[model samples]
Target chain A: MNILIIGAAGMIGSKLTNRLIADGNLGGKAIDKVILVDVVEPTAPADAPFATETMAADLSSPGVAATLVEKRADVIFHLAAIVSGEAEADFEKGYRINLDGTRFLFDAIQAADGYVPRVVFTSSIAVFGAPFPDAIPDEFHHTPLTSYGTQKAIGELILSDYTRRGFMDGIGIRLPTICVRPGKPNKAASGFFSSIIREPLAGQEVVLPVSEDVRHWHASPRSAINFLIHAATIDGEKVGTRRNLTMPGLSVTVGEQIEALRRVAGDNVVARIRREPDPVIMKIVEGWPRNFAPVRAPALGFRSETDFEQIIRAHIEDELGGTFVA
Target chain B: MNILIIGAAGMIGSKLTNRLIADGNLGGKAIDKVILVDVVEPTAPADAPFATETMAADLSSPGVAATLVEKRADVIFHLAAIVSGEAEADFEKGYRINLDGTRFLFDAIQAADGYVPRVVFTSSIAVFGAPFPDAIPDEFHHTPLTSYGTQKAIGELILSDYTRRGFMDGIGIRLPTICVRPGKPNKAASGFFSSIIREPLAGQEVVLPVSEDVRHWHASPRSAINFLIHAATIDGEKVGTRRNLTMPGLSVTVGEQIEALRRVAGDNVVARIRREPDPVIMKIVEGWPRNFAPVRAPALGFRSETDFEQIIRAHIEDELGGTFVA
Candidate 1:
């Protein structure tokens, strides 16, 4: 099977690429050729079992999407998106990239003369709005409060409809915030979730902008990659018409995350996280969904770590050579 | 207020137009001019109190939408759409007209140099797919099973996002199946719902394709127009971020509708509804929502009649000039 990963330069995307290469197969079909695309030229793996090509392209620009999908990949992982803060700040750019760019890709595939492929799209929990129940149910409405979430929700609708029309086999996974994200912190409002943990473990100081009581749903980068793999290979018929699903995630408060960090790396690592109340971040975090009753994804064989301790353990083993700075 | 009614040739659009003309004002603002647009030129209301123009235009065609909103009408009622059955049979046309057409209009509004008008978008209950609770709540997720529903759901999302971004003052009202729709029987799967009530009172026979046990949500055409008007004039601040509301509707079984028909026009009119099971139509109806607990729309002052009898009486009074073929 030929594989294509859009936004392959990003954290989760790169990890997925490495995993696929290591496994050398997806859904029992050997991945013979891989195409990795992003806004900038992606860094290709130095050594790999299969053919690899890195292409730089902006999908939001008219006609670019058609060229990207000319290969007619057997499987496509669409993970490219404008983050929440950027989408909110730059409205036009946000819609252009998130909404129009996605539509262009879907339209390109639909117009590709019967070339239907399994499309695994990365949707975000931002598709939900606040004033939510303690454990938001699957049936809760998608009344997105932000432009980014609205675009993702719209993408979910399009994916479902196109799949129903047999134009593509599409599965959209609403991912939880990835904890202990590798590398430098970006501008995303949720970036603090990762930085608080990653920075402390790296023997650096990081600020906890919000209170420990602020609970959020999370899965490790590894679990998110696994979700993409499972979504790509799953029997789509079992998903029926509802192709988009809220992935099962561990719901933990900031205090619990700190506790988990203390357990894994001890008091020294825990002491690295400092309290600094940032009202802007706090206001943003307050509106986010706290937890979800994601029953379907688990039923479909998409699994994540049961707790934050395991998430931290995985991060240490994967990123720090089985050891944190402590 | 300068009012623009897209799909002005259709039943609800035309009635809404006449209602506006008759009232001579909308939400306390005196009506001055009305622009009516459709695929064909709408018949001008000869004695209309306001300045009126009926223009033939297809909104899906490029530049047409731009011209329609060029005047920047103070209140825009976007009621145009391809019906469900037609959209199902012609997928490309559905996306083109129902989806792209709406987007084109919205983009036009966005591009009109800060001309943010009150956009009253007419969405449908079809946006809510089947397998609903006995009384579907306002917060129920939009998992549309049909292309038509998908299109409407997408429109609602766009409206909400656009409004949130301050591009427009938009309110999307999800109307129930319009009972006793004044027209010849159309190809829509839901058309029979109205025909049984409409044709029977007109001394004509109509088929009851589904069983008596089949329940559906409904509002009179008057109520639908009122919902639109309320959506157009209501304090948008009250709606907040969730701009789309499932309008209040009466939940009635086919047996109840028949009983109302019998009560109003006697056994003869009830007998005019011939039972002929259409497996295809039955299959379509089976996937529709049966009831709703639309709390928000009513709280926001969008009201509907209490019973099906009032619905029949409304049709007789409005369409048949105060008389049915009793």
Candidate 2:
């Protein structure tokens, strides 16, 4: 089996690549070749059993998707997108890469003759907007508040329609926020969700931008890779025409996340967290979905951490090599 | 007030054009100019109280929308789209016209300097698909089964996003199937809904493609025109960020519709209805929405026929000079 990974240089993309290489096979079929692509050149691991190629290409360019589609890989993981902040800040670039880029890729696949690949697209919970129910149901309508969310929602609609038309077998996974993000803290609105846990565990101080009661949906990086693999291998027939599925996630507040970190490590780590509320991020977070009663994904065998403690533990084991600053 | 009507030659568009001329004003403002555009040159009514201009333009072509947006009409009614049958049959033509055409228009509006018009976009109930609730609620998810529906749903997403970004003050009215369509019977799957009532009143036999119990939502052509005017004039601030709304429509089964016809035009007209079920049309109709519990439009002062009798009466009064064949 051959595999193609678009946006293969991002956080989840690199981890998914490593996981696939370590397994050496997907769905009991040996992976013979893999192509990794992104706006910036992605690295090809030296120890992979299969032939690996990595290249940099802007997907929104006119002929880029056509060339990529010509490869005719057995499976395609389309995880490429401009992040939420960047997309909102630069409207034209957002639509070009997120909307037009994805359309070009889908159209290229449709234009190819008798080549149908299992396409796993990464959508986001941002598709849902504010005034949400206590637990947003499986069939809640999309009323996106941000340009990024609007683009993602449009992508989901296109994915379903293309799949229904028999151009490709597609599955859209609407992922939640990734918690305990294994990197240096940044200034993203959502960065506090991860930094509060990551920095404190590393014996460093991290500022909390939102209040303790501010809640959001989250999953670990390991679960994200697993979700992609499961999506790549799941039976399309079972998904029916509604190809997009909101992945299961743990919904918790900042206080709960810090408590989970404290339980996992020690009080010293918990003390590293400083409560410094920023009203701007708080207002932004208010429009986000805090919980979801996702029925379809779990029923389809997609899994995730059941509690906040497990999310932090997964981050520690995977990102810290089973150790932390303590 | 200056107005622009895309697809001005269409049934609803023509009716809306005449209505605007008859009223001589909108939202208490005196009408000054009206621009009508379509793929075919639309007829300009010489007796209008405003300066009328008609032109032929394919909106999907690059730079066409830019020229139109330069006019900056106070209220723009975007009523153009490839019908469901044509859109489904020609996939490329459908996306090009329905999706790209709408996007170009919105982009052009955004590109303009401080030009924010009240854009009344005519969406359709086709945005919703089957396996629906008895009365699909306001928050029901969009799972359009056809490419045409997908394109319209995408248009709605763009309309809402653009409006929220202050590019345009837009309202998307999801109109139900128009009953008693004032034209000769066509082979379109949904045509039978109107033909069953229209043909009989015109002293001609008509085919009933589905069973008597098959139910669907509908509004008269007059209602559609009124809905457009209301949408163009209503308070956008009251709509919040959810700019798209399901318009109020009467939900009636075929048997009920025939009964209403009997009440209006007597048995002579109802007897002209022949029951010859077409399984192909039946299968197609099965995926359509049977009813809707539209709350937003009604709350916003948009109105429609409360019963099938009212729908048939409106057709008789408007299209048949207040008298049927009987």
lDDT of 2 at A33: 90
Best by TM-score: 2
Question: Which 10 consecutive positions of candidate 2 chain B have the poorest summed lDDT?
Answer: B122-131
lDDT of 1 at A257: 94
The most accurate candidate by DockQ is: 2
What are the Cα lDDT values of the candidates?
Answer: 0.91, 0.93
Per-candidate interface DockQ score: 0.88, 0.93
Q: Candidate 1 chain B: minimum summed lDDT over ten consecutive residues — where?
A: B125-134
- Model 2 lDDT tens row, B171-190: 99999999989998898999
Off by over 4 Å in 1: none
Give candidate 2 misplaced runs (Cα > 4 Å): none
Candidate 1 lDDT: 0.91
lDDT at B302, model 1: 90
lDDT by residue for model 1 (B157-184), tens = 9999889888899999999988878889
